[model samples]
Target: MTKLQSGMSRRYFLQVTGSGLVTATALGGSALQARAEPYDTFTWISPRGTLEVLDDYPYWSALKMGYFGDLKTEMQPGPSDGTATVKFVDVGQADMGFPSPGVFSFAIENGMNLKSVFHMGARDTFSIAFRKGEGTRDLKQLEGKTILLGSAAWQSIVDPMLAAQGVDITKVNYVEAGWPTWATALAAGQGDAALSWEGLRAEWIANGLEFEYWLGVQHSTLPANTFVVRSADLEDPDRKAFLEKYLRGWAMGLEFGYLNPRAAVEAVYEQFPTFASNTGPELGTTSILQQINVFRGDMENREGWGWHDMSSWQAFFDQIHAIGQITKPVKAEDVCTNELIAAANDFDHEKVKADAEAYQLSEEFAAIDVENIQAHMFDNAV
Candidate 1:
């Protein structure tokens, strides 16, 4: 088996990796000591294509900032969807993966003993996007309308969202299509509405389309994405302690992103020049800021960052169970654990938040409001 070599830079984390990834020394079990552990190698797989994008700001930032301590992290960009990510983690092809709850649940039923350690996007980003003036305003509006879907897994979200609005699923027509252009199609009256994740919000602006969308979080009790590994890993005290330190740095990167979104975007653009896309800084920074809002959702109020009560995951499991995706009631307790994340937040969060909040931006950056996350979410969204 190939191992991730040392001296690997953060910018190229996703580019190269041998067969095997990481093996680190352990730390104390109970107390979260602010000590870094050294690891020969480890593999981390990204759910998305590259770290240059907005959602992955934390990972890229952490790498550049040396958050992994001495771990030789071999990062790989995942293929197509979370399914590949789940499989990679299941078979040991990857040491860890960031998978959605749906994918994570599926793996559990398939006999993969996985556990979630981090919650990346607490609020659900999945939605049905429509134009501002004529686009869909609510989930109830989807009745008798043609909606474009991304994949079969989306039904887990589509069915429940419609049901929550008291709309019958049979009344809606679902058509599968590729994204980034669905907004244009909806604008041209090709469909009544289109399914969207917040990530696609940038594409809407890229195409100069006015849009507002519905969030799955507002309508359901489910989270968006999380970092996961084998359930067995938690059995090892050293491994678990190492995760806590890693999360500490990861959280720092996320907070830093909020403090200086423009700098974060610029850093990624400078590193992965191909991701620049020539969209210019104003729009890119705005997109990155929009994503930052989602990352901070209810984190302060919840059981710290990445921590969640089982009740929060119930509705999602119930919805998927009805659609035959989950055969029986998948107990949230059996599927996920907040032990590591709870420890990850043991550090002084107030300092991180204050630092980010205090970061002053240049006029060019200040002029662009990060709060205007949805150009179409509200008439006065900004």
Candidate 2:
């Protein structure tokens, strides 16, 4: 057998060997199928706008390659509103939803019954942006200055970081500026600084807006993006199997993207035709890949792809609980299971490693211009 097939066989052997005792005890006379039947359709929701970049081009590649066919996913892209996504999943309007980790954690703590299954991007994508060559070298300089912020959760991350540098948030005037108004507000001198993600920073810098990034001061340990399914759905054997298969496909997609970024970009362009006109397909794809790489940089070598360990989850949960974002603490079991991810790791270690290496070597890893599609769309609408 080939190395890949041999690996698969080994994993199957392990699964069969490990579960043999449990199967004998759990089912004395009943027959258990070796493989579950695939679902007909699985609907998924994602935030609207450029944030859809989280969906990643390799996902499209995987879909085109029939990676998710085993689960029979229909793959629907929904609006970007977190509240709406949560509501849809809770009411059965949607089978799954992707929301920022902060939003999902808050929802779960409040008894939303939303269980996070997979972490899409693994790092804190948010950052503070200031004009280059300004006195905004560190978090300390922001004291007594007006800063534009989105909302409470946004400030939660910033406040702690600032306080660590002897700067109290109360000392700084925090204006309520939505994300749509951030770039303009900062450029128009409405605030001394703005809180944004690296994608936004990339767009602003590309547009000739030079800014200094405070990489040292991060506000939250929460996973920036994640996939969640309703509690009821988890009880269904077919649905559960589908979820496992979907995650396997997703890991494959991510691995493919890491392996061949250019091909993945082409795949995304073909799937999302609108991407062609939005910001130049090449640029958009490059931007998406770059952001993924940035997040992977933290735990690339050790953790493997899309692997969220118990310790990392607990650390992030504790941060949320401490900030009042989550009313009650959630145990790691409440969120995700590493069993399937571990299975994926075992299924194709060499492919995973090769993909990781390719991502580390890609040219897009250096830099890519991100367009402020939010701003551009608003401008065109007006």
Candidate 3:
């Protein structure tokens, strides 16, 4: 679950007016094809910074596993913004891109020829965290309290989530503060709660901090980031071949990562050597793993990998439409196709599960320890 900022048309709210915002096919088609051949190359763009975060893990892991076969991945670095990703695919500069599903709907309504091919992760990483033992039992309890956000940009996201819960947003005070200093502000009692990531949940629990929290996804069964491509790519000169192979590799990497988290980090570091960081290697590993953990909050309960329920998508888009975020009609069937995912789900799930369960880290990766970065990660666990 990560924030995907699709370039929504900016509307000035001068207190006088308002504004608005906004899979998978695989999946496993290699079955009947004779010695499959993957497509030539796929130019893909990521929603976040280039190959640096956990959100890009499966793609990196796939590269590590050589699942791509003949298909070469040409990565175009994103501006680290979701809207940019939507733009990349819209203009055909890239064949595929990743962006938050919430913002993605706007792209479709605005007449972008994109369709989400797979449920990268159906839930967002966003959560509201406040001081533990603050007597806040549920999210609705913050009726008249303050919720802190990094910027006014958060309103499009947090407001819908709040309104969905039936908590009158006007009744609750919203404080704008710099994310760098939001933690201090929260500690100083300047805000009752702050928006955060699910990765912080485990850290707070491990440290015995009773930070009361509610995940936006838990309250709103919304779609998060997705693996998307142009509708033309699905039809003429169809790219489903590449899509299916790409997903298999992706799914494989994810299973391997689960079995060997440290190795997964090392794979990305090794494959994307350009991603040098001032942060230590261990911190990078921990951060990537934590972000990977975000998916499990909802994935573990799903029927299979990359499963996207129509009802969930409807609930989210319905809410968005109800809130006047989108007025143009965009049918889900036109934008998403499950044929590929159904094919992928048909893969040997039982075997994949067993392999992952029995997986052991290589010597190089086994040396990593969570404690190495725990001290630095407690407050900001990406």
Candidate 4:
């Protein structure tokens, strides 16, 4: 066996990247701290290279709404290698990460020792996009057709989603057409379909790259992306307390958005001005609502936000295993836990709703006919 050379940790690499945005103050405690002192900063690394997307509105909403309180936070855009989110969290480069269940499974199978504490995307967000009126409605028709992807690492995400629909994933061709341009590649008639998702459906339309989509929320029953962290870190009381506070911020943020979505969009716009100028108020708000619909699934029947259904996750793992994506029998409990759900949701709902409704909106954002937007939200849903 060959021994690997020792290198700098992912944390050090993140510091050197000069891309981290420090947004808050420290709650005090390092990953290895033995005492009860509060940690300085809690860094969250995104799976993608940019945080300007609408997919993470809850975090930004929390930031703008002062939900995180005194807990200092940093948001880092991890490399687009796909596995870097969980890998960074596992190596202590970041305190938390947002990763799909498929990526989380891969980490568990490879002994990464991470746990998904927050089930953010309660429903499937993955979708297959096709050129308008130029593609078949049937997923089985996708067999043997070329599918464009932003990265080869996304194959792990695409394979299970395709297999769930009775498509022969082995026969489906995936081409890495590069990020922020794969849909352009598809529009250029280079592929039959491209991997797309919910929030992106609206953002793409805003960018004028419209496409018809077979949305996973309407098609599949699998669990979507979730917030994960190193399993070993949870054993520390101080760290766990910090986590509870951090997640509470997200829960409150979700509640805020669910109450008044336009405010959430405004929060994202306030956080990233450039992103606002590009997507604009109409589609940007639409994108925020699109993701919220995925994040809030049957709230009347569920316990609360970030709650995980063990059976659904088990079924997901079973399906991926049947598709040969996972080599071993991986149990749901081994990779995720609902332990933090209650603490994360320990907040006043009515108060959050009050805050959301009272939030002042810009004339442009307030002018959006939200009822009309919701009515047409599913126009391209297959």
Candidate 2 overall lDDT versus native? 0.55
Q: Is candidate 2 or candidate 4 better by TM-score?
A: 4
Give the alpha carbon lDDT tens digit for every residue of 1-382 in model 4: 0111244322222233456542211122212112233456888988876888988888888998799998889888877767778766665556788988888887776666789899988889899999989655589999879999988778888888888888898899989998878989999999999998889998889878878888888878899999998776688787889899999999999999888888889888888899899999999878878888899986786778999888889999998899888888778887788888899999988889889989999999889988899999989865
lDDT of 1 by residue, 311-352 (tens): 767777777677567677787777778777766767665765
Q: For each of the candidates, give the backbone clash count.
A: 5, 2, 19, 9
List the candidate 4 regions with Cα displacement exceeding 4 Å: 1-38
lDDT of each: 0.63, 0.55, 0.59, 0.81
lDDT of 3 by residue, 59-90 (tens): 67667666566667776665533355666565
Task: Choose 3 or 4, whichever is better by lDDT.
Answer: 4
Ranking by lDDT: 4, 1, 3, 2
Give the TM-score comparing model 3 with the true structure, all chains together: 0.69
* Residue 340, model 4, lDDT: 88
Model 4 vs. true fold: TM: 0.90
After superposing candidate 3, which stretches have Cα over 4 Å from the reference?
1-40, 131-137, 141-154, 170-193, 199-212, 217-220, 271-303, 328-331, 345-382
TM-score of each: 0.77, 0.69, 0.69, 0.90
Clashing pairs in 2: 47-80, 48-80
How many Å off is the CA of 56 in candidate 3?
A: 1.7
Which window of ten consecutive residues has the lowest lDDT sum in model 3? 23-32
lDDT (0-100) at residue 211 of candidate 1?
68
How far off is residue 165 in model 1, in Å?
A: 2.9
